[model samples]
Target: MNQLPKESIIKLQSHINKEVVIQFQGGRQVKGTLLSFDNQLNLVLDEVRELPSQRILGLVICRGALINSFAIDGMVEIENPYI
Candidate 1:
């Protein structure tokens, strides 16, 4: 085949799991593994870790309310078996 098969190629989906740091419009920060997304470009993240205290934060608002700006760190490059 000149191209790839049904599942031979890895698809990054290129949606929510795009690894991004969204600065919600509420003056808050969110960091997590993109769990899912919606048509409105809203994200459902898993393994989420919040800054300030490095604690886990649940679902949050995605409105561009208090947002100043956002940034993407990048894919995690470390592997520590013990947390």
Candidate 2:
């Protein structure tokens, strides 16, 4: 298999440990702390929360295929309260 070029990566990895909002294909959105990601854009997030209802989903792995777009959630700090 051919290796992905460094610049070809989506650049999400740089945001690790930060809060992010992911928009899915069907208008669904999820917000969480970005734990990690891969070349395919698959995301591992902690403290996941669904929008609107504000439901908690804990840790989750979001497939890249279902992701329409994503971004860092505002300028708010998302540090764990308990430390």
Candidate 3:
């Protein structure tokens, strides 16, 4: 894999443990807490939920290639007893 640009690395680091909504092709969207990412922009998320239907997905890894765009999670309160 090619080396990730410094700005991309910094952006990913800042979003670690934060929530984000990743929108992919074909109108699919996934929302979850950002767990980890790589130079490829592949993402691992916890407490994931598929959009529209809002199905609760425990964990998921989204392929960077399939990702079209992503939005930083807004001011929605997340209730997690265990920090």
Candidate 4:
């Protein structure tokens, strides 16, 4: 199994329990609180809701292979490395 990069793990750790938006293959999107994640990129989310339609899905476990992309909800300020 391919291991997650250290930077990616740190970023995910920072987003734990925060709201996130996940886009799955075939163009489905969901919004929820990030509960946990694994090196495979598999995720466990709570209070999930389908995007656009706002249908509630409660808790969900998303397969890493099916995830297209994901972004943390709202603005996140990154420390400027060049500062």
RMSD of each predicted structure:
10.9, 9.7, 9.8, 5.9
Question: Candidate 4, residues 8-79: lDDT per residue as tens digits?
Answer: 534588889999999899999999999999888889999999998999999999999999878875546689
The superposed Cα distance between candidate 3 and the true structure at residue 47, in angstroms, equals: 0.3
Q: State the displacement of the C-alpha of residue 46, model 2, in Å, after optimal TM-score superposition.
A: 0.5
Residue-by-residue lDDT tens digits, candidate 2, 6-80 = 664467757899999998999998899999888778899999999968999999999998998788855455789
Clash number for each model = 4, 0, 0, 0
lDDT of 3 by residue, 1-83 (tens): 89955656337888899889988988898899999998889999999999878999979999998998878955356699897
Candidate 4 global lDDT:
0.88
- On lDDT, the candidate that comes out on top is 4
Cα lDDT for residue 68, candidate 3 = 83
Candidate 1 TM-score, C-alpha based: 0.49
List of clashing residue pairs for candidate 2: none
**TM-score (C-alpha) between model 3 and the true structure:** 0.75
Instruction: Mark the regions of model 1 whose C-alpha exceeds 4 Å error after superposition.
Output: 1-12, 15-18, 58-70, 74-83
Better of 1 and 4 by TM-score: 4
Give lDDT per model, in order. 0.55, 0.86, 0.86, 0.88
lDDT of 2 at 4: 61
Ten-residue stretch with the least lDDT total in model 4: 4-13
Better of 1 and 4 by lDDT: 4
How well is each residue in 1-83 modelled by candidate 1, as lDDT tens digits? 49853451323255455555655655566676665644434556666667656687765545433445445564355688798
